[model samples]
Target: MRILIFGAGAVGRVLAAMLSPHNELDIAARDPKLSLIEREGIFVHGAADRKIWPGTKPQGIYDIVIIATKAFDIIRASESVNEFIDENSTIVSPQNGLSHVDILTDYFGHKVILAPTTIGATSTGPNSARLVSLGMTFIGSSSGDMDREKTVAKLFDHAELPNNISNNIIGEVWTKAIVNACINPIAALAGVPNGTLLERNSLLTIAEKACYEAAEAAIVNHIELTHIDVFEWVKEVMRSTSENRCSMLQDLESGRRTEIDEINGVLIKKGESNGISMDVNRALWTMIRTAEGRRLP
Candidate 1:
């Protein structure tokens, strides 16, 4: 199978390394990383280890196309993938929030698979990524095609990518979003790693409130959560990846646009519509927006 992973940063680097050895893999990447891969190949370490060379351009129509860009880039990224998609292409989205779910589904219909990975991967440098924890991936289609869902699951299994075929993928996706919504924004605002929240009661309390707010919103909206208690799951993630900076923190520190809108912004919309108030999420959302503005031009 030919697979193309668009956006070769962090999670994308780790995925390209994992999937390349088993399939004809191609990756879409920018400047130095693209040239670096062409010259030195990609090295993946930590939880999953591998070193493989990946092409910078697609050879032909890919059986699977993974849109690995940050949530902010989804709308534009989805449009660029059209050339690589044919009648049978499967578009996999491993994004963190539920925001990009409908956009990709509405764009590609059944071929779009909502895949959310909890893998704690970060780009170490120009040509490498370290997987802090090998989090499981949940795979299912927003269009609800079980057959295609299983097929993609089988493909990942063959590629040595850890995953589960979810009957309730939206729920699974929401579960990840909830954990991220609770943790990422607070981490970004506080300028701390995830583990720091564990030691600080104030931050942990804020995260828990955000988690509870989002969880209640999920229940109110009738979205089933795979995790019975989301805050516990978030704490476990924080412990396991203690030293790693959350993506939101990384984005904020680098002066890049954070996915607060993609993560918290979407949650606020859902929670407000459900009349959950979502005060915690809204506060973090506003702070992130203000920070983003300060970084602009």
Candidate 2:
């Protein structure tokens, strides 16, 4: 199979290393990251270990096009890879929020697949990514095409990525978004690792409240989430990736734009538009926005 990963960030690199051995792959990245992979190859450590040398860019249509760019950068990434998508191409969205999946649908139509993953990994460097927690990667179709989703699931299975094909990808995406909504903002503002938050009752209380608010907001919007216990989910994630800093925290520290708007902001907007209250989640969103303004140029 031929695949193209549009962005080579932590998630993209992790996918590249995972899929490279099983299929012919190409990475769409720029400068340091692109050149680094071409030179030293990609090294993944921690939960999973693999090394991949991306030799050259492949030509022609690809079977799979995974859009691993940040939520804010999805448009640019989608546009840049538009020409590479053919009728049979399957585009996957492993993004953190709900809006990005819609944005991709606008650009690529029904080819867009919402396949959010709970796997925790961070880019240690341009060519090195460390797997923090090997969470389940859920693949589901927003367009209700079970066959298509299962086909994508096969690709993941071939790559040995822990994944499941779901009939409710939207719920999965929302569930994942709320989980991030619960931890990301607090973790970023507190300037602490994920594990520290779970260890402290005060932080856990804040996360639990945010989770409840986000869940209420989603329910009000007519979205159905899976029957997973969110508070327990948050605790398990914290324990799994104890020392890991989430993407929002990483972005703030590096002065890069964060995806608070897409995660917490989504819940806030839904609550405000529908007369639902999302106080705790709204507070987290406001604080993260203020931090982003101060940190980014």
Candidate 3:
């Protein structure tokens, strides 16, 4: 299989390294990082450590194109690789938030797959990454094609990546978004690791409120997510990634724009549309945006 990972950041590098040995893998990166990876290959640490490169810009339609870019970059990344995608190519979005699948499906139709992953990873530098925790990734088609979902699951399994085929991917996607909605911003604002949110009663209270609001919004939007208790799920994630920095916190610390808009912001928007109150999410969204604006030169 020929796979093109559309970003060389933390998640992308981890997936690229894991998949490169089994299938032909190519990373679509930009500028200095692109040049560096082309020259030195990708260096992966933790879980698996090695340098590998399937090459770049190879001619032919890719069997699968994984969009591992941040939520905000989905459109630009999809457009950049439009030529390499065909009716046969499956585009997998392993990004956070509920909006990316819609964006990709608008461009690629039924070929888009919603992949919600719990795998933890952090970038040490450009073209380099470390896996923090191993977790299962759920794969399902945006159009609900069970065959396509099974195919992706098989591919991921063959690559030794943990995966499960989901019959209700939208529910799963929104569930993950709900988890992010509660934990990410609190972790970002508290300037603490994920475990801190669970450890501190005050922080945990705020997180619970956020999750409740997001859950209410999901219900109003007709999204079924009854499989797991939201609060317990959030706590489990916090415990599993106790020392790991949530992506939002990482972005804030690095002075890079976080995915506040897509995560908490999306909840606020959906809440309004469904006539549900999202004051908690809205406040967190505003706070994160304020922090982001302060970093501007």
Question: What digit string (tens of lDDT, one per residue) describes model 1 on residues 171-226?
Answer: 98899999899889888889988899999999999999999999988988899998
Q: 138 in model 3: Cα distance from truth in Å?
A: 0.4
What residue pairs are clashing in model 1? none
**lDDT against the true structure, each candidate:** 0.87, 0.84, 0.86
> Candidate 3 versus the native: TM-score?
0.95
The list of candidate 3 runs beyond 4 A from truth reads 226-228, 294-297
Candidate 3 or 2, higher TM-score: 3
Tens-digit lDDT string for candidate 3 (178-273): 988988999999999888887899999999999989998988888999355888988888898887778898899889999989898888899888
Alpha carbon lDDT at 228, candidate 2: 55
Cα deviation at 140, candidate 3, in Å, is 0.4
Q: How many residue pairs clash per model? A: 0, 0, 0
Ranking by TM-score: 3, 2, 1
TM-scores, in order shown? 0.94, 0.95, 0.95
C-alpha displacement of 91 in model 1, angstroms?
A: 0.6
